[model samples]
Target: MTIDFTQQALQVLQIEATAISQLARFVNDDFNKACQLIMDSPGRVIVSGMGKSGHIANKIAATFASTGTPAFFVHPGEASHGDLGMITKDDVVIAISNSGETGEVLTIIPVLKRIGAHLIGMSGNPASTLARLSDVHVCVQVEQEACPLGLAPTASTTATLAMGDAMAVALLNARGFSADDFALSHPGGSLGRRLLLRLEDVMHTGNTIPMVPTTATIKTALLEMSAKGLGMTTVVDKHGVLQGIFTDGDLRRILDQRYDIHDTLITAVMVRNCITAQPQMLAAEALKLMEQRKINGLVIVDQHQHPVGAMNMHDLLKAGVL
Candidate 1:
């Protein structure tokens, strides 16, 4: 007898999808009340559960913490021994259990209550003891498990995770969390680098800036570009004000015209009114601008329009902003 694994896989997907769809109806006043309690709590959200629900609870806690909800997970079994001290009166406890009668979880309810912590219960059975004890009950009820024998927690766990995500996102929106705010908590990730890295952080500054005077000959500009190795040089006036930019492309065009590099003023051959960036501009934003303009380098200028820094595509790539 050959097992049709593909058909079984599709059946499980459909069942889990249906379970998530059914969760829409459960996002009612009780869900809103739960969000309000978590928002109003002075301390962090304490999440606890047992068995497969415990695994889901750990992920829910991580999601909440990353999305600005300030939450952490505690094992129900550990809480009975010594971890219950992690909960405080100012905190909100979110307890998860499919049966709602898990002995380890139920054992600590009285202690949590005695400490004056608010309880939010998530269970598949709404009429279970955990639901009655909770200040707000979120029912993650699903019709059936995606498991073939209806024994393993499949669709039920998916529904619970989706519900947790919904709650975390609702709180995130309510708090007016911005991308920059999210990036703060994820400083070591790529998203954080894109949002937090500034042009000044990666641009070639000080003596490394490729620059030539507006009155300098094209030959002098070429020397500056070569010395800095940025393939371009900014042409500035006597007061250090930006006059224009001359690049290898401009040199190639000038060479095509057979202009004398020794005699031609850089100002006459450079690109006037060139695209520039400020020091505070984001590197990601600068990369977009460069791609849009089909340019390889940018001159960083200050309020006085004086060139302060310079960077090329290689710099952005090295800085991980490419």
Candidate 2:
């Protein structure tokens, strides 16, 4: 008889999903108190657990840190060997144990209480020692393990992880954490670029901005565009106020119109009343605008309608706004 691997995988998924869905009932008054505990604390959060719960605890700590709460994970095994010094009276400790009887974690509880740090226990068994000893208890109890052996911590870990996310999100909303605030802590990733980067940050500035006077010939505009390497040129008046814009696309369109490049004034052939952007606009917002208008570039203008910068689709791509 052949065992169906796909059916077993489906069973595992269903069990885990049900386990997570049932976690809603576990978010009780104790959960509300835990959130208030973290919020009211002036110190960082120190999360601790052993084995599989340790991994889940580590991820929960990361989520807390990224979502505006100061948090870090400490290995319970290491805590017994002088690492417990990292915890202080002002900090909040999140202790995780599915059975709530893990020796290393239990061993540190006495020291933590001596240090006066508040304890929040996450355990499957509400009657477990950890729950009984903790200042507050969060139940991550699941009906059954997704593992066929009922020993691999599958559904329990899933439930615990979901509970951690729910906690982080609740705290996040309470703190009014914004994406820009998150980007400050995660500055090297695409998410940071999307949240923190503005139009002025990516747009070509000063002499690099491609521009030609409105009276300049189409040839002058092409020269400016080529020199700036932006594939487009802003047409400004004598006062440097934006008049219009010209681009490679404009060149291509005018090619069919039989215009003399050197003799035709840029204003005569340039797109009049062209789309523009403010320097303070978000690069992501600008990308959306460009996509909506089916445009390749935008001229950055000041409040007085003076051209201050210029950017193209390639600039946005280079800045990771795409």
Candidate 3:
């Protein structure tokens, strides 16, 4: 007999949807109590479970740790064999079991309690032994299993996972956690580069900067722009202080005005009020300013207002700051 793939998929979706819908009812005072308990914990939150619930517990622990709550996942079976030593008085223990009676998890409860760890029990049964012994019981109960066999933890696991995320995000908001703090834990991601990388790390410096003195002709500025390939040249005084910028846009305007490119001084045709960035500013912030001003490039200056470096939209793009 061939299986009806569409029917099977619809059945799974129906079951999972019902499970998620039922989670709203679980968001009562007890949920707040659980959040409050975890928020008050002074040490790490140790999440432990068995079977599929254990898998979800590990993800929950990771979410908590990345969002500013110190947390980790421990195997209940390992806990019974001396891994319980990792539990400290300054830690909180979260135990997950669909039936609330996983023998392995139950075996470690006494040790966790003895160590003065606060217990948060997540289960489908509110009156189970785990819930009865917990400092806070978070009911992740569902009406039925998404599994056709009604044996695999399906609906209950979905509800449990959502509740775990709710707990983590709530604590994150309450703690005033920032993106910069989150980036520290995820230094390899794009968000980390935006938050931690400074403009000086990517801006063009030395001979790479397109620069010309105020006495230089528009033709001379054009040569500097072409050689540096930045499409613009910074108009500086003899002291190297930036006075203005002559971009391709400025060149177009000058030509339209019939200025003599060979005889006209760059300062006479340059756009005075050019957008600038500080060397110490965050590259991400510079990108934001560029976007807001609708400009394609910026001159980076030192504390003394001397032009030291420059970058354009292409530079930010190449650096992945775009």
* Better structure of 2 and 3 per TM-score: 3
TM-scores of the candidates in the order shown: 0.95, 0.92, 0.94
Greater TM-score among 1 and 3 belongs to: 1
lDDT for each residue of candidate 1 in 1-322, tens digit (9 for 90 to 100): 9887999899999999999999999999999999999999999999999989999999999999999999999999999889998899999999999889888999999999999999999999999999999999999999999998999999999999999999999999999988888889988978889888999999999999998898899999999999999999999899999989999888888777888889989888999999999999999999999999999999999999988899999998888776
lDDT of 2 at 148: 87
Clashes of each: 0, 0, 0
lDDT of 3 at 86: 88
lDDT scores of the candidates, listed in order? 0.94, 0.93, 0.89
Local error of candidate 2 at residue 27 (angstroms): 1.5
Candidate that beats the other on lDDT, 1 or 3, i.e. the better one: 1
Q: Model 1: which ten-residue window has the lowest total lDDT?
A: 251-260
Report how far off residue 155 is in candidate 3 (Å): 1.9
Error of 1 at 153 (Å): 0.6
**Which of the numbered candidates is closest to the native, going by highest lDDT?**
1
